[model samples]
Target: MLEMYRSYLAACNERAWDTIAEFLHPSVLVNGIPRTREQYVDDIRKTIAVFPDYAWQLRHVVQQPPWLAVHLHATGTRHQDFLGAPGDLSPVETDEFAMYRIADGRIAELWGTADNARLRLSTHNETR
Candidate 1:
């Protein structure tokens, strides 16, 4: 499961849109909301559009059977305003944590959050 999770992240970093369905179930649940695999792909696409150079670097991971917990360092240069930060193409970085439930070797459910407040603070400070 750990290796598979890593591969999933790899595909995301590669912006492999066509391969996303291979890592996510057709009926995926994200943060308690039901979303189709295409919706998930759209969400990723929107984020990448805002942060053209976005990447998620794995900081930690733990796997317990069908559950996987991940900590990631997400970084990018903003192409548009985000988290109250000006869209001056400044660098932004944040920590993200997520727990995933895998079904049939693909992610079926995910609960995740990112440190947006910290990123906002850092960006605000930089503008000072």
Candidate 2:
């Protein structure tokens, strides 16, 4: 199961959405973001466009029946426009953690958290 997560991350880092699809269930729910498979793929593509050098460093993995929690640090430069904001303002490094429900050896659902305060500060230069 940990290997599956690793492979998924590797595919994501490589912008290989097709490879990612291979490890996800047809009904996969990513980070509680209600998107279909195609939408999910598009989201990833947009993310990579915004953070071209985005890299994920897996910190820890905990596996249990029907679930896996993954802690990771995602860091990258904001090199392109993202979410209606311009890019190249500065590099942003954020820590993110995700908990996933695995079913039939594939990712079925996911919930995630990130350094939102840091992201906001880096995105708009405002402290919250």
Candidate 3:
């Protein structure tokens, strides 16, 4: 499972959308809300559109059977307006924590949160 997770993260960092669905269940739940795998992938597409250089770096992980807890550091430069922030802003850095529920060797559910305050501040920073 750990090796699978590493491959998943690598695929994400490489923007390898073609292989992403292989790691996700056809139906996934995020934050308690059910979503199709396509919907989940679309959300990622939107983010990448806004931050073309965005990348997620794995910092830590703990896997115990069907449950996995992950810590990631994400960074990206704002190339377009997003969430009330102007475009061409400085790089935005954020930390995200994610909990995943694995079912049938695929990611079936996820609960995650990021340091949005810091991300917003970086995006809206005037000094940039």
Return whichever of 1 and 2 wins on lDDT.
1
| Ten contiguous residues minimizing lDDT sum, candidate 2 | 119-128
Please give the CA lDDT of all the candidate structures.
0.87, 0.76, 0.84
lDDT of 1 by residue, 29-73 (tens): 999999999999999998898788889999998888789999999
Show where candidate 3 strays beyond 4 Å.
123-128
Considering TM-score, where higher is better, how would the candidates rank from best to worst? Answer: 1, 3, 2
TM-score of 3: 0.90
lDDT of 1: 0.87
Model 3 residue 60 distance off true place after TM-score fit, in angstroms: 1.0
| Candidate whose lDDT is highest | 1
How far off is model 1, as Cα RMSD?
A: 2.3
Report the candidate with higher lDDT, 1 versus 3: 1
Clashes of each: 0, 0, 0
lDDT of 1 at 21: 71
Taking all chains together, the TM-score of candidate 1 against the true structure is 0.91
